[model samples]
Target chain A: MILVMGPVDELVTAFFLKHLTDTKREYLFVDERHLGGDVRLELDLPQGPSGKGRLRGAVHFPTWRVGLEELTGIYSRLGTGNVEQRKTPEARAEQAHAAALLDLFPGPVANRATAMLSNGSKPCQYAAILAAGLRVPDTLVGGTWERWEPFARALDGDPVIKSVSDERSLVKQVSWEATRASARPGQALAPHQFQQRIHGTNIRAHVVGARHVLACRAETQALDYRHPDMTGHTVSLRATELPEPVAEACRRLSRALGVDLAGIDLIEPPGGSSRPEDWVCLEVNTCPGFMWFEQNAGLPIARVLADFLGTPLGS
Target chain B: MSNQSTDAGLISSQDLPKLAEAGHVAAPTVGNSAAELREAVQAALAEQWSLMGIIDTGKKASDLGKKAADALTDKGKEIEDKAIHREKDARDEAHRKMNDDKAKKHGREAGAHGATTNAFARALSELRG
Candidate 1:
């Protein structure tokens, strides 16, 4: 049985459920909106010899009680909105317990909690990307004016300033003039990430497991193409192909990041050359939203996910 | 496990162990109470959440540090402006002092020349006498 965890109202979740229904797969969904009412977890862990212990539990939903051992795979997009804001001790404890159980789930989880840690820090993600033999833009993190001034002066064009962490901060281009204007006579006070901006089309490659890759090309001039275009409409997405080496690099990046499923962002330089070396690795997104890719690329992402979970399409 | 059906879609209690026997499901290891299990899970989650919190706190601290640095930069700019003004005032004062000294020096030279002329005229008169 496959276990899906997330907000039921989420479009992604709905899509997955619809695909699962089409495949007639036995599955359970743990909705965040209903903790005690719609779902409750009763887990028991017994003391046993080392390496011999097994976790036993059942997640009771209003309609089903799913045995822990029956779970073949888990697709978790659990957000912290419902649990993170609770101040009560009971709620906190329940959430923590749920998280622990999730961590302990022994199945083909799309991503284990430990593997997801890299996304918390872009630097960590970049290191993984670099380890995968992908090129990352030159980056400077948290330096004083003394350091930034020379770096700014050396850059051929404006550098992109962004948050070092994963918080959604605007990718603002730092013109040489802006940097000079903002310069003060001391070390840089707060943490900022500056990268040599690469001019190219934004390519997002969704790597599913090791075998499946869906590449999408987006045309936009924004520093971050994830945001809407100037007309308040989303940037157009179309199915595209990557150079063989670049595709292999993306696969390697996915494995290095310990994610079976990931959205790997790359920049294809303006030149006609499709060489792997010409592309720059931006970052790996752990929980990528596939709504746009599904809508625009016409790729059956949900069906693919079902297949990854051991349920073939039209099973 | 009881054989009673608590919910419709759930597997009957009797069928659970049978499924386990069939190797469709593994037998559950039993010991801790549900509450204890919840507590354990919560403890584990707490650790994970704390780690996440640490990262978040670090980000916040970084942002605050940036804000403070920006404030310091603003203050520095203010001081820089004041210093520029002070430098300009000092330069103007020096220029005024130099100009005043030059004017005084010219005046002294003129006075000395006038005295010399007067003395010469007086000597001429005496000679004529």
Candidate 2:
């Protein structure tokens, strides 16, 4: 059975739902207050009356509904800040702890919750990818602005600054740099990521089962890799055959990370195009923009999904 | 255990578990036609382009409005530069025309006076100065 909990958008749900083949495989979803069953939780804020506090009426999770338990795998995309915070602290912790408990689930959880949470951190992911023997750009994260002069001298130009965590996305921040003249260095930069830029082509490799579908994007734009004003720039999508060694590396990486699927972003210098080994792994996306690839590439990503689901082991 | 990949896409929900029982799952015929897929891609691209256009139009309008305000604010400085050069050109042209008129009027006036009106002209030049 398929149990999808937390925030799954309708756009993705449609394609995902189209792939379910087994009738007994029931897909169930739940959040904090609605964990496969109805449970109303109200706030215990008190109103002071006659120098004493009185309990106020409680409030439940808004638009809450769930039918959990009768499912096998659980696919989660919830975050600490987004939907979970809407519930009370106790409830949020409860749901998170519950999701974490699913790693012990008999069937494959799309992502082992504990693994995802730990790998979800940028530093953790960077370290894991590096440890996996996949190449990643040399990144340095520090709060010291005093090192800028030397860093710039080493870089020969402005340092690319970005955010490491989810709330501060580097996708849009990749294009901008901290100029020597404008940089207030340490005083201005408290919680930000400044790394030496990697000059190369951007590649997004989506892995499903044993198949690896590669999407390469050369964002020759200013400020970010995914340019918001991405017009006039052309990007082509085609299936890239990764060498056996790299394919195994990706599989091993996925296995090691305990994720069923991952979208690994890589970069290769234009000069390094002659060899496959030259492709440097950038970062792995646990949840990728599958719709974008399905629209751009005629790979029948959805059908591939259906095909993958249509058959059982050795079938 | 969680749902397996074999659990998705029955097309018709009837006899769904028969797929698992058979142990051999049939690959869906949904992806075969390359041309059909190509058409779908084109249509999807067109729709995305339309959506992008709407978003771009809004952004462009906002940018244009900002530029219009900046031009309005900074137009005074540009006008001053043009006016300064214009004043110099007008002054030079006025002096040249004055000399030419003096030559023409002075010749006729001198003939009437049986003497050059250069003296009177000089007097007029001093007064003009």
Cα lDDT computed for each candidate against the true fold? 0.59, 0.44
lDDT of 2 by residue, A1-315 (tens): 354443222223333443332222334333332432333323232333322112222212234322222333455543311222334555555554554344433344555544444333466676667666677655556545566456555763456665554232424223224344455644654565566666776666666653545444544543344422222234455555555566666666665565665777777566555344566776677655454555444345545544433333233
Q: Can you give the TM-score per candidate against the true fold?
A: 0.64, 0.54
Using TM-score, give the best candidate's number: 1
User: What digit string (tens of lDDT, one per residue) describes model 1 on residues B51-124?
Assistant: 33444455456547655665788875566556546644654454444335434423343333332233543432
Runs in model 2 lying further than 4 Å from the true structure:
A8-15, A18-26, A31-33, A36-72, A80-90, A118-120, A168-188, A209-223, A228-236, A271-277, A299-315, B1-129
Point out where model 1 deviates above 4 Å.
A36-38, A44-53, A62-64, A80-84, A180-187, A231-234, A272-275, A311-315, B1-129
TM-score of chain A of 2: 0.69
Docking class of 1: incorrect
What's the chain B TM-score of candidate 2?
0.31
True contacts kept of each: 0.00, 0.00
